[model samples]
Structure formats: C-alpha cells, structure tokens
Target: MSEFAIHSILLGSAFSTAFFGLFAVLNAVGQIIQRVMLLRTPTWKRVYQKKQLDTRPKDAVDQLPWETWRLVAGVIGVIALLFVLWGTDYVYGSIFGLGAAYVPSFVRRQMKDNARWRLRLEVRDFVAELRLALALNVTVSQALEHIADRSGQVTTSFIERVRYHVERTLRMESPEKMLEALAEDFQSEDLRKLLVLVRAALRGGMSLAEALAQSADSISQNIVASAELSIEEMPTKLILPMLFALFPTIMLLALIPAVSMLITSLSGVPGQP
Candidate 1:
C-alpha cells in the first residue's frame, strides 16, 4: 500500500478505537456509580432525611434520592470540561459522555409530563363522577364514598382521602378546610378551580351540588374540544416525519437496483484490447 493509504488506515483505526474506548468508559463509569450508591445506603439516607427537613413540598423531595448521583455527575462534567479545554480531538466525545449523567433527569421530566396529562384526565373523570352522584341527590361525603368504590385506580386513594376528611369534617372540622387540604395534597389546578367555585357557591348560599354539576359539564366540554383539536392537527404534525424519515428510505430503495445495474455495466465496459 502507498504511504497515504497506510496512514489513512492507521488514522481510521485510531478513531474507531477512541470512539469505542470512550463508550466503554462511559458505561463503566455508570456501573461504578450505581454500585457505589448501592453501597452507601446510610449516607444516602442521611442526605435524604436532611433534604426532607429542608424541602417544604413532598414532590420536591423526589429529587433528594438523586443528590449523590448529581454530585458525581457534576464532578464528571468538570473533568470533561477540563479535558475539552485541553484541545484534544475527542473533546466532543468527552462532552457527550459528561452529558450522559443528565439523561436520567431528562427522561424523568418527560415521563412526568406524560403523567401530568394522564392525571389531568383522571381528575376530569373524578369531577364528572362527583357531578353524577350530586345529580342523584347524594350528599358530598356520600358522593365521595360512592365514587371511591368505582373510580379509576389512579384516583381511588385520593377519593378515599377526600371521603375520610369529609366524614371527619361532619363531626368536628369544616368541610371547606378538608377540601383545602385535599387541594394542597394533589397540587392540581383543575381541582383548585373546582374547589374555588364550590366554595363560592356554598358561601353565596347557592346549591353546591348544582354548581359542581355545571363545572363538570364545562370540564367535559373542554376535554372534548382539546381531543378534537389534537385530531385535527395530526396531519400537520406528521408532515415533517413523512418528508424526512419515510421519504429518504423510499428514494434509496427505489434507486438502489438501477444504480447497481449502472455500476455493473460500467465495470463491464473495460478498456478495449
């Protein structure tokens, strides 16, 4: 082989080795981190307890378990950033490996977004069930208990909690106070809005059940409108994927045989002897 060809081969081998080495190192680092976390249960518990004391909302405490991992990730990021500053050829790989640590949180956020949509639908159903029960002349506490029997798995515990508070309120405390607590526990905007309307109607001497029935109608209508809009927009959303993903594969498939035949014909047309 010529010097140029030899050098090209060596360079390609080096690049491949470096790429595979970096990937292996990243995977090893992740495994090491996981093992270390598993071994340090006491340390993790201490940090979790401290975080729980410091954080107000229960939801915010979810991040506490990842604190050690975040710290490890930050250290890795700093090292990668330093390596990048050294002007190495694999600087981009280092940066990417460093970013791998953040993948869990990003994935968690996406899952949470999907969960939020599902939870919103569940809340809508809960409200509609309440409306139906109220329409049948059931008292609020009894309505909550009735829904608890037939509600979705997602809202069953919430329904039971609400029913518990309602029963307690009837004996000693105010039902409004329990509703306020329930709203806080769920941290749902729709629940809060419904509570506000219900609270207002009760304070205004209007029928609480009737007001909730109207609110339920509004919620159902809004959900239907949203679904219709999403269906209407589906074709627009699919345009880019069809243009980029499906189009290229199809063109390649259509041209491959013709291109191969042309190449074969060109090779057959050798220099005339």
Candidate 2:
C-alpha cells in the first residue's frame, strides 16, 4: 500500500476513536449529574417528570437540549479536523479541531451577552416610560398596561409576561411578588433593581415617578459606562488573538527566507550530508 493511503487510514482511525471517546465521556458526565441531582434534590425527579409530561409548544431554543450545541460543535470539529488532515498535517489539524469544538459555545455566549445588553437598554426605556405613564395620575397596573401597549418589541415580551403572571394570579398572589419573580427570570441586576424600586413605590414607601426617574437615569449612566469600558478594553481583548494567530503567521512568513538561506549556506559550507 502507498504511504499516503496508510496515513489517511491512520488519521481516520484516530478521528473515530477520539470522537467516540468524547461522546462516552460526555454521556457519562451527564448521567452522573442527573443521578447527583436526583439524589440531592428529591424534587428534581418530579421536575424532570413534569417537563417530560408538559405539552406546551416550545421555540427552537427551548426544544433543543442543552448539550445539542456541544454535539453540533463536535460534528463541526470533526469535519474541520478531516479537512485539515487532508490539506496539511496532524499538528495543525488537532489545533484547529480543538478550536472548532469551542466555536459554538463562544458564539452562543456572545449572542446571550448581546441579548442581555439590549434587554438592559430596553428596561431603561421601560422605566422612563413608566414614569411618564405614572405622571398621568393612573394606578400602577393601569400605567403598566398603557406602557405595555406602546412598548417596543424588545420590551413587549417581557411586559406581556409580567402582565400574564399578574392576571393569572390576581386574587391569589401579590403583583409585587409576581413582578419580582419575572425580573429574576431575566437575571439582570439592573432589571432587578428597577423592579425593587417599582415594588417599593407600589407599597407607598416612596414617590413612584421620582424613584422611576432616578432608576432610569442610573440605568442610562450604567449603559454609557459599560459601552465606554468595552471600547477602552477593545485593544486589550484583541491582543491575544493577534499574538496567537496573526503574529505567528507574520513571523513564519518573515523567517522562512532567512531560514532557507541559512540552510543553503550551511549545506555549501561542509560535507554535512
């Protein structure tokens, strides 16, 4: 058999072994986590059962299991590994495979970060609008309904969710508790603080409009500061990529001719076969 064919077979076998090994490890870890959860929290089994029994329609993001992205990343990594192996050598292929495996998670994290930032801005606008609505001498619920009616798409879903929970448990639960629970779902500190201020206003602890205006101003300032900090740190964030990717390529390109000349000169200098 030709050497290239042997090399291809070896690469294929190694890829298959690595892929299955990774799968087995992930599966085992998931099983362990499930078992631990079930053991430590008896309600976990009930929660899992309830989720399985629930028949509500779900979005694409909700329908997929958490590990689905990892599987997709693995597939992409395998494809990248194969392509690199065919085009180059094992070292580059391995490096690229590992990097490819992390791309899905990195992209997902970046997307979530962007969505959270947008939500924070939307919450700021919502607080400002709520203050305006309250100044019109309406009840808190009426003002919320008015704002919900006019809210942009980003805040509409959140406001609608709050309205839904409030209406669903109008007699059984306090609106403040429902609002706080919904805010906690988003897991935004700014949103939580805004909700706390709104709750305090609802209980007549402070002036609603003034508290909301202050919260809006604070959120606006925070947003501006976050933007400025991101801008200031942009070069620092870029340094690692330049060092790992661009710098190496540039250095290799710059050194190749010199290394070739040194090899040629050394070859001519002595009988160093």
lDDT tens digits by residue: candidate 1, 51-95 = 755533334325445545554555555555555444333343453
Model 1 scores a C-alpha lDDT of 0.60
Best-matching candidate per TM-score: 2
| Model 2, span 1-273: residue lDDT tens | 223433543475366447744985789799999888777876877787767555222223334454666776667566655654564334334444545566655667666677668778767877777788889999777776676566436334456555555555433566566556666656768878877887787778888886788788889999999999989998998796666466335534554554455567767964345
TM-score, structure 1 vs. true: 0.52
CA lDDT of each prediction against the hidden true structure: 0.60, 0.64
TM-score of each: 0.52, 0.65
Q: How many residue pairs clash in each candidate?
A: 0, 0
Model 2 local distance difference test score:
0.64
Cα error of candidate 1 at position 210, Å = 3.3
